[model samples]
Target: MSRVLRTPDARFEGLKDFPYAAHHLEVGEGLRLAYVDEGPRDAPVVLLMHGEPTWSYLYRHIIAALQDRFRVVAPDLIGFGRSDKLPEEAYYSYERHVAWMREWLERLDLRDVTLFCQDWGGLIGLRLVAALPERFARVIAANTGLPTGTGMSEGFRAWLEFSQSVPVFPVGMIVNGGAARELESAEIAAYDAPFPDESYKAAARVFPRLVPVTPEHASVAENGAAWCALERFDKPFLTAFSDRDPVTNGGERIFQARVPGTRGQPHVTLPGGHFLQEDCPDEIARLIADFAG
Candidate 1:
């Protein structure tokens, strides 16, 4: 049996702007992945994938804005949100995350997906798109990248070191700090809800280190393979990166230059920090909704 912990339901009680009912799926033995499935079942699927230290709650605003016209599927990756967490941190890996999401997406039979991914979301989601291009209709990348171990930024280096060495994994404060505007205490508390204590944060703590920052990194070759496929992906791709995120400020240029789909597209730079969803959800939601249409 894989040692796992499921957060108590009470921890997520009365979260601000996150009223969607929870849906669960068995991703592995004794591990159930949770997601928020809202809007009409037959509508176009808009898959919202979140990143490290934050769960689907990070996209509550975006979900609320787009659920009216699109089927919004926001999943809590294993070890985050209401999903089951592996008590042993060593079990987590970049490839494992991509595989877990592959299972989740296949089981759900999500097709014609308009993917909105950020942070680690892009790392894993982009791989899914490369491996299964026909499943996606369009893509919108924000404050995220698929790194193949070259030109790693100083800001990311500092973040990686901090994530590995921080005594207390302050999930809520980390999200707040990554936002351009300050978040309310209640909102911060909601971000903290998924992890009852530090042990549940093993996945978050390991995410920064899992990033492929060098050629020797474990996921480098796999990511390079994905990039090869992405180069040929002619589907619509948009980069709505934010202006204030030091971690990924110049990443959009690389995507636009490399990806065939980015040609002639109106790529944008929104005003916000790394977690632009929180800082500019309405604009981001509108962009996605318009792009999907």
Candidate 2:
């Protein structure tokens, strides 16, 4: 364990279009995980998992659109949003993230869940599905993949280099750069809110480097095992990738080919970039609603 930092509550004040109250669960010792729990408690759960350099705020639009029909629970990954952050980047790892979120999921006792995961969300969330396959009913993966240390994309390699070398890790600017549409100054600020200063950005800075793109990476074998579980998953998996995300342009193909649940599914390529939630939230919401129904 390392020294933990929690973003000041004042930093999150007056966020745009993100009105849901955050709920907290102690997932680790002295660690409180922040999440948005909206809609009917008894309604079917639709877990929205976000990726790097983003938080549950990334799913505000999708949560609003789906809250009326389903229980939308979106959690900020331990270091990303309202959750506790570790000042030491070394404290974060692929397996630890999965273990933390797994504890959070189990503590909530979420069942028959419909997961909508993107980016590292898929990396961690898919591992959750693989570990607790019985807890998930279906999955909607968008612009995400489970890499097994085979190879890295040119775009991802570029991102890796930029992330490690950049002097000032601009959280908001990096997010804005990934989206297809230009983010308003406020929305961009919300992304920046989680990290008031550079000290709070250890998790964000290390996330890109954590992707197991080589055999020597830590989670390679674990991701390989997770894929084996996915291959046996037959519960209606869908891939709604975007048209403009260079980093993960055709990443969905492997899931369609390997996962039995992808067969006969209407996988789509939406008009957006890596952060498609920003580009087309309503459409993504509708797709999830229809798919979950």
Return the TM-score for each candidate structure.
Answer: 0.98, 0.99
Worst 10 residues of 1 by lDDT: 24-33
Q: What would the TM-score be for candidate 2 when compared with the true structure? A: 0.99
Model 1 misplaced stretches (Cα beyond 4 Å)? none
Candidate 2, superposed: residue stretches over 4 Å from native = none
Error of 2 at 187 (Å): 0.5
- The CA root-mean-square deviation of candidate 1, after full C-alpha superposition on the true structure, stands at 0.8
Question: Best-fitting candidate, measured by lDDT?
Answer: 2
Model 2 RMSD to the real structure? 0.6
Model 2 C-alpha lDDT per residue in residues 133-235, reported as the tens digit of each score:
9999999999999998899889899999999999999999998999999999999999999998999999999999899999999999999999999999999
**lDDT (10s digit) by residue, model 1, range 1-293:** 55788899999989998898899998856579999999999999999999988999999999999888999999999999999998777899999999999999999999999999999999999999999999999999988999998858888988888888889999999999999999999999999998988889889988898899898889999999999999999999999999999898899998998999999888999989999999999999989989999
- Locate the minimum summed-lDDT window of 10 residues in model 2: 24-33
Per-candidate Cα lDDT values, in order, are 0.92, 0.95
